[model samples]
Target: MTGGGWRRTLPLMPASIPSASRENKKKIPYAWELVGWLWLAYFMNQADRQLYSVVQKQVQEALGLTDIQTGLVNTVLIAAMAVMMPIAGFLGDRLSRRRIILWSLLAWSVATMLTGFTGGLVSLIVIRSLATAVGEAFFVPAATALIGQYHVKTRGQALAFYQTAQYFGAVSCGAAGGWIAGQYGWKHSFWLFGGVGVVLVALMWRRLKDAPKTAAAIACSEPIGDVLRALFRTPTALVLTLALGCSTFVNMGCLAWAPTYLQLEPFNLTPARAGFFSMFYYQLFSFAGVLLGGRVSDKIVGRRPAFRVELSGVSLLLCVPTLYLMGATSTLWVVYAMLGAFGFFRGLYDSNIYASLFDVTAPRYHSSATGLMVGFSFAVGSLAPLALGAIKQSYALHTGISLLGVVYIIGSLALFIAARGFFPSDFLRNQQTVPTSPKL
Candidate 1:
């Protein structure tokens, strides 16, 4: 071009750098504004989920529930998560996540607030369980997918930090819920927790815009059938779905029955004391484990991505044993110690879950990929908690907890197989003795 033509356009661009350079330097703005909202939203998500376990006594007394009836309260919530997650997944991949998340936070928070006024199991079933679950379900798919999109190279570390809010909110919610329920009653605690969420929802409404520009941007206006077809066509997506489902089964089963076990065991603690002790130990450890795992995996993946994921497998392997041993042990010190270890490993597994998914799926597929993974994981795993509750009402804690190991092992195995199939060198490079070649 002529010098005059170039000179005229030069004013539009930065004189020091080319247009290409500017585009590269233009930050995506994902982490600072977007991921922050997502992280906090997830934190509140878990805080509400866990607050119930800590305030079980006040809720039970207020409603006059029996053991099975109390068990139904938890089952209702899990069932909501299980049933709603798939539909949430489809919506996340098809609709604007910003809207889905905002509505979700609002719906759940409102339900939680209403839960404070419940007079019976029926109210608990509708408000706390079903409505709350439906709200909670949409956020994770939207939020987690956003995290993966924003923090490409640092997906594990970023998600771990975001997820830490969950542990923080969970652990903090327990301590706070205990105090609130102690002071005002369980009803007040739910009101307080739900109120904070409602305020955050308004804030999210302001900050969160529709990022309809991600994977779903392709057919931004297409029919639902095309999106569904795209999801099933991915091989890595299918494997991840099964792996996560198996992992969640163990988590739900233990979460539901463990408290009842602790309350009745040689430990023989009251519901309130048991609440403080169990949530304190496990969530605290889970907090530490997740933080540590994220950092460790980040370090490991710098040299090798596959190695980082396989390192996460060690957490599950350790978790199964530690959880079982914790339940078996009678001493408070021993129980706490083992519980801490279990939490650490559990964090390790969770920290790497979507990071592993990111490693296999390309960046464009982040939402739909996680949608598939989250859908099957929660849906399939939802059965475990209900089953465990029934078992606790029928059989020994030993039997129920012991059975959970089977599911945990299966999760580890599915991941192990996937790792072996594609990245066998990772485990060998890692501490595990996994072979260097795929058998097939």
Candidate 2:
């Protein structure tokens, strides 16, 4: 879906959208000079997002918090992100996504550094919950939207590579955070992470350009409220949002509990070891899943276009069975394989969450819509951890896994329905292509 050849998004910009100026088109697809910095930024984004989770054991013991309490704390963070998204989404539309992303990265890093200074529960909650989510709220929506802007022909593939950095960053950080906790202490990790973000922000500010807006968008600018209303009204957007919410629900639940689960009876691993390994396995598989899913989605979408979404539904179907197996298993290797399989299935849906959205939304609203999804889905999904944690605290890990498996089934159904009914068709929308490709 690059800048040239013959690209049509919808009723908005029907004339064929060409590749970028010959110079851009001529650049190698993975031209390090062009996309390297953005990739680095993506890696950092995941590092920060998952770093705290990686160190959950140390934090829990040191602070003397409950599973539900920690879950509640994370909930606060997600909620903040959710609440900020609509406003940020709106800003991303009217303002600059690149600037918003840079600022967001900077803000969260500062909050991360502040996290190291806290001595008690309240302070940790404030730093990790409010400040962290608030800062992150702006980063993903804007950054992803920005990525989608540049890569069109290979939108699925490009976004996949870009998003792969997130998995790598997180997997690296989760392992690093464990080692840091084991050696220098988690406090130092926070300080170092914060500094790295500050540096990245400075670099991005100089490089990123605003998404190229179409002449039609500028000429036929819709009222902001009207845009918002229309966006919410889009059947595909609504369905995609709910479908994503379900995926996030499973992800959050599994992430929050998997470490603790590993630390339990059969595994009996040390806190640091369990934490590292738990994250290590899932993310390892998730990386492969994401990359493959992106490639698969590209091929499928190229053929059916509706398969852009239907494939995800299929993945969701696969996910439920494996997730059930993941939860019910007691054997370490079995669990690992199941977790990997789950991640693989999940990758298909994760990659398509926004591809489906990009199919329906206007170019100007792309960032805004992305923000809304980032904020709301993340926020809503935050509850999964809290719920699972409470269930673990009350009953057994088995119970929670079983419950989560049920949730996956429900979410899978939603995706199936969306694929069948809500997938936006080029036939129904206009001839113009969505100006922005999808951000993963």
Which one is best on lDDT? 2
Instruction: For each candidate, give its TM-score against the true structure.
Output: 0.83, 0.89
In model 2, the worst 10-residue window by lDDT is 9-18
Model 2, which residues run further than 4 Å from truth? 1-35, 216-221, 424-427, 430-440
Q: List model 2 lDDT by residue over 267-313, tens digit each.
A: 88775777677767677777787788788877766546566667777
* Model 1 weakest lDDT span, ten residues long: 5-14
Candidate 1 root-mean-square deviation in Å: 9.6
lDDT score of model 2? 0.71
Task: Tell me, by TM-score, which candidate is best.
Answer: 2
Question: Could you tally the backbone clashes for each prediction?
Answer: 0, 21
Task: Give the Å error, residue 337, model 2.
Answer: 0.9
What TM value does model 1 have? 0.83
